[model samples]
Target chain A: MTTVGEALSALCTPALVVDVDKVKRNAQMMIERCQKLGVQLRPHMKTHKTLECADIMTGGSRRCIVVSTLAEACFYADHGFDDILYAYSLPFDKVERCAALSERLDLFQVLLDHPQALEQLKKRPLRDGRRWHTEGVELTGIYAHCGNTYNCRGVEQIQAVAQETTSFTLQFMEKLKAAGITCKSSIGSTPSCSHPVKDMAQLSEVHPGNYTFYDVQQSVIGSCSLEDVAVRVLTRVIGHCPHRNQLLIDCGWTGLSLDGAGKLPTGYAMIEGHPNLKLLSMTQEHGRVEPISGPLDYSKYPLGSLLTLIPYHSCATAMMHPVYHVHSGGRLLGKWTPTRGW
Target chain B: MTTVGEALSALCTPALVVDVDKVKRNAQMMIERCQKLGVQLRPHMKTHKTLECADIMTGGSRRCIVVSTLAEACFYADHGFDDILYAYSLPFDKVERCAALSERLDLFQVLLDHPQALEQLKKRPLRDGRRWHTEGVELTGIYAHCGNTYNCRGVEQIQAVAQETTSFTLQFMEKLKAAGITCKSSIGSTPSCSHPVKDMAQLSEVHPGNYTFYDVQQSVIGSCSLEDVAVRVLTRVIGHCPHRNQLLIDCGWTGLSLDGAGKLPTGYAMIEGHPNLKLLSMTQEHGRVEPISGPLDYSKYPLGSLLTLIPYHSCATAMMHPVYHVHSGGRLLGKWTPTRGW
Candidate 1:
């Protein structure tokens, strides 16, 4: 944590501080891409869920937004982000609470690719028989999210699930139309979003949260590149053993999520700002910094100096901290705090 | 996330849920272990940092503590835990902040292992003949944490580190002795604690946090076993796809800390109760569950059902959630929030 001042001076030690300027650059770049693609930008708040950030990301209007957890939805909704897509398919048991939240807002949506959820929804007693009574009072339709990938293959998997999604949508519209349900459907994944075979006319809208920060996983699907990672975990060297050619650093399992990009290095995180440095492996509290070139930058990576680390997967990396230390250049800026859990 | 009532109610997912009864049992077990070992138990609040749990663990004394970050030290200090060990070695530049925190507390200790840290302490204002003047009064003598683990091989490693630790302790104490300097030296790690050579009489106390919650890593190091693992992350199966021989579950990277036991499976967490169930792999938002045996009890892992997952490393696992859903068996128990951040 950095110490506070008139312009709070940054603290030493390679901590998980974010550069606010980098976030702005990242956000603005995404906004531009969304504009070019003609897609509505509902940036995933799971990355940096701070109010000051939400204001900047939303550009003032409580526009369409994406959230991974119900707590996030409640947070933005309470602060007035009405058009919400609970991007992750939360369990059916949470429907009642989700319904209660929906009644307070103007627009709330969900994502689902499983048939069991629809079955659970139809059977659940969410209506009082007048205006849809759940818990106690009368509300309306439950917020829905549609999943685009499930045991998905190159093409066949999505075609099968899209067919399921299409049929499910028809069935849902039929049920909601007859019973006067007020639910909306939005379907997408990074794969479907990048190479969309289906049209917008097939669905109400689309939710592509990862499109903003494509990772090695997205690159394998031919989406982005190694240079496009918007965020990285900053760390420092702690122990160096030359005989083994391994340098132990503070960034380890806790610093970087043990997520792998299929067929790539198991150590998903790479050391940025340095060309030769690569993270070969990690333990709970220590990361093994392996250099491609033999014994490079021993001085720069001295036991106390900081090093920037970009993770294999972004969302999970984002979730590992309580707040993002927003920054730009070498200056200290603001912060962002994401909501966790259902 | 389980509801306050549901978490407290009857069955917990797989197992990390510590019922208040189990919490008491676990806390008491450690306290008793410490008593038998003839050692003072300065519990690492990192496991379960709830004040309620702290109260139970301490019984009633302003006991010494081992914290990972400065924020944690300040947090517990404000809550009446005056004696603390900031168990992380910070960069040379952050020495001032540690000193500032130490000045505020009755006794605040920071970890130091490398020569760089020794140089950092040596190059303080004392070397410049300019005493640190912070927040009005001139403060002095904040204890230092000397971490040395190379000696776990035998008493030689302990003795070597003790030699180094004693020198550092003597130097720090000599510099600030006029200001009433008193140092608290903790010369131990889980491995060393499991096999202590000599009781480094020079060292004042011992700190072996992971010893209390023996994990698979510790077990490999001959510390503890599966039964000794008292905490686990509970999750439920949401989707199953046999074609890939992979089953998708709601628990993802955020729910589980992508930390995996080596060679066992590159992905997935350890399934405690059901030995056959294995976490094959995972994505940012999904975990692939598989059965190590043929035709397993798929009932316990059905959609909406729960399973507790033992962690690869206990410290990393504990940070994934804000609260612990405690349980005792057929009874929903209580909730406890942990202390987070530096």
Candidate 2:
């Protein structure tokens, strides 16, 4: 049997390596945290976007979950995951697919943050002339996103944004009620959800995707510590430019993603256990690494040596790959392929 | 028959729309430019990975191409493309696959920028105990990348780096010759190739990938003009958050990649014909658009209205999609699915 450590040698460069032990711990901690705060942890699948991770996040119940794409909602629904929230403003083009999914699944919901979105949803209906609660389709809720929370400064800033978003969602829900459509209100993002507030009682559930794979960005934002990160891009040293004092890695923007670093450092991502090594820049297939302090021995990072990095944003980085190489105790357990598409 | 413009209404939001007329013009312009310079335009397939685009790039001959990944090499080779160059430095683990491909195709090349990479290639032997060259497989060339030119400030800086890179590559090719393996020297990038350097005669071929769909980044780098860009992300205004002076669109990091805007304005991407509208930020499924000058006139961008934006980096944005919606004369010609995987 090929162990995870051994499998890295066989797999291609710039691959996603998921520590299942870390993943479970991350999932469990978040689940417990939300439980303490009296909120259901409807784990957002946009971060990991795999059935295996979803199962672990939901504690193998597959009862309630959240997704960013209609494709992901259909994927989980097909895999027997019933209660799903398509946690973005509902695209009018996908209503039919959502209706089809809602027909079979126990509950399949979509977000409608704006009144215009609801108007668009109303314009598109089944041939039978029914709207949100048709025979085959029933939207479980109307989700409102405080995406602005991502731009917030600290916990207090996130909390204030969360409070405003919750009020806006409550009022929007009232508009839906006035239209004779009754549905639950939903709100979240990692930062907003991490801050417990009195406004929590207004929303039905919280879906914070990045908590499962706390990235360097999240750590910088005070959502989680760097130690809480569960996923890393395993890359190899390909070349060393002596004059430039740079080490070239197989991980490029395509691997690690070009997600900007916020208040962390002047680089794309951070190298695990290598505070001195900063990813200075990236091309499509080449990541330029420079020592933050100063360069001396290029011999230390020999060609073909493996290096793991914590991405600035886990969702953007994870979306680059087709499969996650799942491992535990440094043993290759299996692979988890994400549902691809919009 | 579905006209291209008509097809946009049916496709999922945030789809890749390729103006084939622009693409043809772009290809012909680069091809003719290379012809005048006395060089072959081995159009890099990394921008548009579809075979149809490759055919157009090769002017229907489909003879030679440059790819970013082994997956692209295998993909094009499987589609009857014979001569292929995996443009980036060959990862050590991919040598076996490279050897296997070289055995079947007329020509299959890889890159070697450093001596260590060449050393790894030396260790990996073909089935019959030959390293690089065997009965069927032969090393096509020693490729070099002027990646440093991407960091260059101006035309002169790029020219200087291009000159240096060519000399470096030529010297490395001589090192291979000393090891009893004769091979050609290859080098190129959009900026270096577009500069029309006298050093071009030293390399066997020029492989400029992004010229096929010159982006905002390329335009800023003096590679091409904004009008030459052929690919765009088609998005719809889903919401207008007046409080934030932002319009929410279906395009997000998942649709329009997080590749930074280099020397461009402080936005994620440039909306074609809408200089006022700046994509300020993005979540996984939400792109926040703001007016660069003043508050966005929400009426100007009606809900569900489609807008196209030129990505900062075409290759990175195109990588996010599985297929390209081909259009010309404001008519949908057909669909082009890119070969996906590593």
Computed on C-alphas against the true complex, the DockQ of each candidate is 0.38, 0.58
How far off is residue A330 in model 2, in Å?
A: 1.3
For residue B106, model 2's alpha carbon misses the true position, in angstroms, by 3.1
In candidate 1, what are the lDDT values of residues A1-342, reduced to their tens digit? 564331323544334555555456555765665465555556667665656566666676877877777778888887878777776564655666666665666666654556666555555443333222322322233333334453354555555565566567657777877865554455556545544444334455545565444555655555446555556677777777787776777766656667763335435565666656667776545677777667655666677667777666666666667766655655556566766655
Error of 1 at A26 (Å): 5.2
Give the C-alpha lDDT of model 2: 0.79
Model 1 lDDT on a 0 to 1 scale = 0.59
- The regions of model 2 sitting more than 4 angstroms off are A1-9, A35-38, A127-183, A191-203, B1-7, B128-142, B147-183, B195-203
Winner by DockQ = 2
lDDT of model 1 at position B314: 66
Worst 10 residues of 2 chain A by lDDT: A128-137
For candidate 2 chain B, the 10 contiguous residues with the lowest summed lDDT are: B128-137
| Cα DockQ of the candidate 1 complex | 0.38
**Which docking category, incorrect, acceptable, medium or high, applies to candidate 1?**
acceptable
- Number of the predicted model whose TM-score against the real structure is largest: 2
lDDT of 2 by residue, A1-91 (tens): 2344565556677888888888898888878777877767788888888999999999999988888888888888888898887776667
